[model samples]
Target: MTSQRAVERGASVLIDAGSLTRCRHRLYLDTAYSALLRQEPENPGVRQRREAARAQREDIRSRLSETLDGWTEIEAPDARTASELTMAACRRRVPWIWNAVLPIERTTGRRGRSEILMLDPVDGGYIPIIVVNHKVTDPGRGARTSRLTEWAPAVDETRKVRSQLRDQLRLAHLYRMLDFEGIASPNAHGGAIGYRAECILVHDLTTVFDEYDARFLDRLSVARGESFTVPSQVSECRSCPWWTDCRPQLVANRDVSLVASGMRADALREQGVSTIDELADFSGPEPDNWPFGSFTDAVAAATAWRAGVPLLRRTDEVTVHRADVEVDVDMESYQEHGAYMWGTLLTEKGGPPAQYRGFVTWDPLPTVDEGRSFAEFWAWLMGKRADAAARGKTFAAYCYSRAAEDKWLLDSARRFGDISGVPTEAEIREFIDSEQWVDIYQAVSDQFICPNGKGLKKIAPVAGFEWRDAEAGGEASMGWYREAVGYDAEPDTTQRERLLVYNEDDVRATKVLREWMSDRAEIEIPTLESLRSAV
Candidate 1:
């Protein structure tokens, strides 16, 4: 049987799931196609499978004829003999023998290069085993291509690398039992006569029946049109390329079982049940006779299942105090001189603080908010301070050694400070040094934060707050934002909306983080002292 149009397909399905049924047929196809893709392309699995399958086919053929005197299969003894034997088998009229052989020459074209070879039963027709490595899909199956699909000709370089593998196979004298479809091109040179054949059946004797398991061999031999029942064990599917389609069907039909206990647990978890709700009966803390480790995990999984949800927990609660103040705080301003001045005194009354708050200016040029200038920002700070005083609230801000928040506020102050009578840059620097700001990052690293690097993204999540985006604009990078602002050109209204959305998201995230910090202190009270003392 000569096959001229061979095809290959790629997919991302994992071998573990019951969904592998779809991959089984593709696996067999891939095994053959992979031969066309290798550098010295020889797929031991494909060759072995095809040989074993051909053996079964020949067994059936011999049994059908009572006059058959003898039959023999010669394993590839050597290069010359293997090639000669294979060529003889293809040309024989009565005595049919299947051999895997590689063609001597290759022709290249737009579609892809094709390797021509003769196959068994070549008596009346040219059983050309034409090999092609290109992308194709089974439209009848309604299967769409994935990222694995690409423009065929665009990958000529990659194709050449793979074709070299065929060159090595030609020298190995291991080319038999391999046949493919015809080769065609989009350009000048038309295509060659294509060889067509029945589906390529692959079987691994070591797998279908193991070293000591031969009882099934008899059934496999005589069974003409029936699919012999193989072990439904998933391990059988896993190293097997056809695992995708065959394994799932086997499992659903109760033909296969996960023998590995750990694998069973994973399979169950994947099914969205981590508990005993459906698997076992439980009254309280634990279930009796739980098969896997940690009945607690199983119980959680079961609960999630009944609730129609995933078994994983996402949030942990935390708390903080209102009195962790340690430093003074104020906003800074800047002039064209590049010097800065701290102007808006927002935290002069409180203890040396651990953090600071600064107003971030949103550029709304061509539609500027006159009252929203830097000076207005300073006036707003004083207004907030006065309002807090009426309620007996002292503005105490805390800043770490790096003074990240302070630096931003300082810049803001100088840029928009009430220059009429604001403190000079030198005086502002003096007040900053007097605050004795602590460096939480250093404190934690040098025995702080309980053995973890000090990043707010990490800490905040552990404290029950996740980094979330409320809008797509929030996810835009600095480069994207700059583009919206037309960094080098006139701004558009659409860009203004994007910047507004981004600024709004920043403020919202900051507020959420502050609230999370307070909540964390309450939840982790037991560990609060350890965390602080560690630093």
Candidate 2:
């Protein structure tokens, strides 16, 4: 057995004089382009250390081959394949170690040979050649010039080493383009392929350039040729990294705000509105030709514009925030459990003492009940409005001083509308607006005075109204009457009467609190922004 080693030291080679005579077997080790070649080993420890290093390197090569799929592993001839793999691994490793040691200069970096290797099934057998290259096939325009400049020197060096290994191993016949996992075709731009019929082939040079040794492998090439374009679709310039430089016309005149609004601008292409100006002008509101849906949509869009929030679909959970004064107005019906005409009172402030104004629905025909039915009750409430007008008091139904209870009041109003035979959403909106109905809880939340979390009791306290405290004492117990009705065998009949009484109390309480809020400064009142500022 014979052992021969020629150390390569950057384009220079050194061989031990004793190596030529030590054994019967002739071994020729060459490092023709390295400048750090040494002539001789000082001791037996050097060979032992080298063998250990070789084993470790082989282990790394095996692990890497298993780590990523699609790459072929190769071995070198005339040396133990494992030893060659290890040597290749060492070659790649040394550069990185040098890179860390002299990070600023990056001079000592060399492509390690893990990417190309030599293999020997037996521990001390002659290594056979196995050319393995990453089977990445990128089906796009091949490497371009601008891309090539960015390649790291380490990568260039690796290529050179791999090329040298291929030449030495006589593996040129195996030079068919193998699919590389990540090597994108520079010409194809972004196209991908795992295999290429193209004759391009990369031979394994892991004994020289390990994959990890070259961090710039992916960026080693550039694509210069124009990529193939689809007939109608054109190229995906908009998504390209060089889009700004390559397709200025397509990206220059963008309306940032409109795009930021999250409206699907792509959908508006059919309307001949590719740009924001075209969209704004073409979809401008037509006063006379207003369709309710279109009008609402436009309004919603405009609202989003002003609010600086995207126009989102309407949902029960998502509330549209407005800066307008929030008035928590509740309405009450004249009847207890029965459906009929009603009166509404609104209160902005919350407290035991509340003030409010009542508006009665006009119901000419009255129903027949033992007591005043809801219709008849409305007639009486209308009389109160007349009396207030006569006395120089505001006759409006909406109150801004206390929390209003208006569940029944709204139902009654709808009944009046039905009876009046006026069927229109606009009419309903107008009627509601005329009442100036403000949701108390919403108002408080908008005002930023209350926690804005839920619950009427929580909101009422902010306006100096304590509905809980007011109803807590035995002086007035709305719950007991409600319970009594429930306990009674005939709830509809008995509950109706008690419900009316409870409704009356609620109305009165709301009214009292309203008066206190309008006149007193002791209670805290918050502006709309304050209420919603928790976020």
Best by lDDT: 1
Where is model 1 more than 4 Å wrong at Cα? Answer: 1-372, 397-402, 411-423, 426-452, 467-477, 492-535
lDDT of 1 by residue, 1-535 (tens): 1222221111211111111222233433343345543544333444433443344445443442343322333347664566455555444532423333332222210011112222222223222222222112211332211111111122221111212222222211112122222211112111111111111111111222232123222222212112223333433443454455555664454321322223454454455433444432333544234355555444433333333332122223432223222222322211111212222222333444223333433342222221234444445544654566676664333332345444544543444444543434564465445423333333323322221223544343444544344333212333333345454466465754554444333333333444545444444433322322443
Q: Estimate each model's TM-score.
A: 0.28, 0.26
**How far in Å is the alpha carbon of 33 misplaced in model 2?**
77
**TM match of model 1 to true structure:** 0.28
Off by over 4 Å in 2: 1-372, 390-392, 399-431, 435-442, 452-454, 468-505, 512-535
Evaluate model 2: give its lDDT: 0.31
